[model samples]
Target: MPPEPVAGPAADIDSLFQRGYDRLYADDSTGAVRAFAAAVCLEPGHGEAWAALAEANGGGAAAVQAYAHAVVVDPGGWMWRVGLAEALRLAGSLNDAIAAYRELSGERADSAIVRLGHARALSVAGRPAEALAEYREAVALRPDDAEAALELAEALTGSGDALAAVELLQPLSRRAPDDAGLHHAVGRAWIALREPEKALTALRRARDLDAEDRLGAAPLIAALEAGEGADLSAAYVRALFDRYADRFDQDLLGKLGYAAPELLRAAVDRVIGPATGLRVFDLGCGTGLAGIGFRPLAGFLAGVDLSPRMVEKARERALYDDLRVGDVVAALEEVPESWNLLVAADVLVYLGDLAPVFAASAKALVPGGRFAATVERSAEEGFTLGPTRRYAHAEAYVRATAEAAGLTIRLMEHCTPRREKGVGVPGLLFVAERPADRPQIA
Candidate 1:
């Protein structure tokens, strides 16, 4: 997928190396690996062959070893170093990726592409501020480059400076009038600036240009909805969580002041007392924030999430006894009546209809077991999907839903689940208990 490791023509190259190149372009990764392995065997000094071998092997442990060998054989090959850095980044070795990226910067600080790559690595490592600095440098190096401008605009947006991002992207939009992605970026920045009309205009233009472009379609649909929708698409939610898995905690907790997990744990404690040795299940657990907080109260803990990457991230924390990668409802069905304490803090935002989740939570809980969670509160009856792509539920609707689902409300209180743009997001914290006399779920 990365361009050939070597510079210039491969016309004079050995037969094995040429055979490997043919196999690689043909998409036969295994054959390419074997051919490249043969080429490197014949010429142990061929750094390019080793690098090619690494790529053909899909950049696993073997790839890392081969890339390391390539770098050693050709210490001056910046391309090989870049390959290794990219491999490390894909493998979730963020620190190693950053170190390798720094090595590239040391070789050529003015290389805009290398600087951009380093900035991206830093972003993935949850160092957005540092990534912003690198992006600034990259933009300064190549002001007219569309790629660098896009990166800088995205970084500025993430840093809560949509006006700055708009300024950066406006000129690019004019320069590349036909670029659908550029328009999409500008529309998102406008939306952040509270200019919904402008965002709609730009997004509509983007969709007109490229109907199938992913960024334009999802946001365009959300923008078109304005303040009403049943719920967001499952595919979109999965993609969003997967992409944010790396920086979910840093952005939500440190940047946005998200305290739902702590609040939910406290509420649970008040309802069941502290350290009750409950069997806990965390629905839509992203990185196990709530699970970690509830660990002391649990005799056994398990987690479930729609995004596999988010599940993997939670697994890395090693707090849960088990973790499932699929829909929350499907996960609940797997262990009916197994949990004494089920937590879904900040996860209800994705479901505009609370009936399904409420019913599932009721079925999954043992007699007298508690369901504690947070939800963005709606001013009107029932629920509505907000412009932020999260659903907000009304207090009356929640109470009625819990009653119908066979759960008794133990506690309901107002709280700020998190902040957006330094403003608190209004929400509700609730604890409901399955009736002790209710029949067990089949």
Candidate 2:
């Protein structure tokens, strides 16, 4: 036989599909999309072609539709399902993505990577318990998987099962002794378990390993050293806000059930007695959580956050007249004697020492202007840093600081702002006024 006849259209389509995959691997999404489309035209039944097109769709609705079609065409392909789940996750349909992962797991329950993906999806979807179970399954399948163990530990800690998380990571911690994240996880576990001394030791090691990456542990160490069990440093507070800045409203307010901003607003209404056309600056306003509460009371509203991402998100709400990215202390100093209302909700808990902040806020306010703030309750500790390294001043200390800064206390009361250790922590709300002739605090 001089020349052998080529196979059917399906074979031709397979060749074209190879070309498309090569294009995909070479980072030419558009070319790959075109090639894949051509392959699908050549064989009409090429499931991989549909999947390739879907992957190349780059967040387009048409791309998702193509992926859906690919899944329908080849419902048995684990690859297709994985691609679809990943695309959905990127599109921010976390719950839908999670459902896809679950479906994939049902089909291939023994796939360690799939199980790991499932766990990640669950964690992002805020189903930490389910995620933890999936992570455990993944670990059981492959015990030496460092990523699986570390991620599992994170989900466990985030879900408030720190002790269990520690157990999961204890062996890995011994092997990967120098991993900063591992040590940090151990420290967090100790902290959650209410063993401050142990937490201090582990967290200190974490910091020593990589100071930049392990920034949160410093505050926690300070808290332990200071003999305060329930205090955190400003750095820790900032880290908390930074990590949750994008999802603060949903995770903190929606999931964890917080209402600090609203509680502050109610307290302010009672003390200030409803005034119209008031200018309000929500200092430390991460993602405008407090701005929502200020909407009714404030005629002019502005917000500031240290994280630019938070400031951008706050701007998206159209609730702020201006949003600035800078340190709150600097922002306060820049706006000397301007705003009538300065509300710092859950802000002062970060400051181990309030003298500087008090002075800055005093300078920022107009004469007779009110500064309303919230602070987490702490037993008298004479200004020592706690394990969390955030300063929690006693009620008397806070009052003394405000008074020393030329702000006379107007209203002081206690309320529960948010939960700590599965229970609400007592917080104080104070509204103080800077007098006309502010006495200098030496």
Candidate 3:
């Protein structure tokens, strides 16, 4: 009877799965995703369809979900598990990716690909020592793998072994002279070694070779040529903080002896005399350290930060009524006249120019609202970007800018907000108030 004419969802799922594979092979990922999605919807137990859907979507949360389903349905499918791990990594789920990779490594200890993926995830998660160990193992497994060698060299540079990174990268660069990434890595190693001229040459070559600017060499080149007034890029700051978020509190408080939050709180207390029931907004409210002190005084508490990971950490504190990932100046400008107190403890170091921030803060505050902040102090005439890539503003500049923004200076005192390299960093704690009778800025 010609196979009794296949019936039910099983036959339909098979047809859809075949169609999905056909579309996937033809490079029509969107159509393939739709087909595979339909097949899985028809039969949630179909592991193969879920795997195909994951492959079609490539890498994202959706792919992560589909691969996860496939892993659940057919736990023996090693490739599906690997795909799920990679999808988690690509979706910025670093901790989960690390966990998945750990499982895979335990199962297949000799797989170089698994080792490399684990190493990359660890490196991005800011666990440099662990990442370095994995990279070394991956390289050992595949001694001739150039990419593995390059990753190890980059990790070496990150771990502060500049000389070692240079020794590895120089020969590697010679072997692949046309590779832009190799050149960029070489440039970074040279910069760490304090060989600015050599760094410039390699960076320029990388920039010339990479028309798309994928490696972000332009900003580094600018920082090298224009030392003092150059502002750090938002992307750089966000990435730096994202990597640092997990270890931030411990590192800053315990190791660095950070006292910015306590100092700022004292200054605010002196200015307003234990004021309570104020509408408070914490700018760059990293891990909500500043917010913890201000929370007791706030009738309403809100925060904004550039790094999403930092914002996530802050959210966990449950101190903020509202939390957002955004630029501080933009956040200030967005909700003018909404806040009675604006706190920016140890945050302005990322910005070289403070005029815009001062103006925005003035406008954001109520007529009698107070703006408090800590800034690293510089002896330069205006402001300068320090070797650490943080901006330091001279007291004269801070006073002049606050006045220009129509904010009345209430307090500007010298203080040490934090310790760096076992030495106290010179800083200023300033509190400026918007005039009670002055009209808000347009």
Best by lDDT: 3
- Candidates 1 and 2 compared by TM-score, better number: 1
Writing each residue's lDDT as its tens digit, candidate 3 over 157-222 gives 676566666777778788888899989988887777555767888999999999999999999898
Whole-model lDDT, model 2 = 0.77
Top-TM-score candidate index: 3
TM-score of candidate 2 versus the correct structure, residues matched by position: 0.50
Evaluated against the true structure, the overall lDDT of model 3 is: 0.87
Q: Is candidate 1 or candidate 3 better by lDDT?
A: 3
Candidate 3 shows a clash count of: 0
- Predictions ranked by TM-score, top down? 3, 1, 2
In model 3, what lDDT does residue 96 have? 98
- List per-prediction Cα lDDT, in the order shown: 0.83, 0.77, 0.87
**Could you report the Cα RMSD, in angstroms, for every candidate shown?**
12.0, 12.8, 11.8
Q: Candidate 3: worst 10 consecutive residues by lDDT?
A: 1-10
Q: Following a full C-alpha superposition, what root-mean-square deviation does model 1 have from the true structure?
A: 12.0
Which prediction has more favorable TM-score, 1 or 3? 3
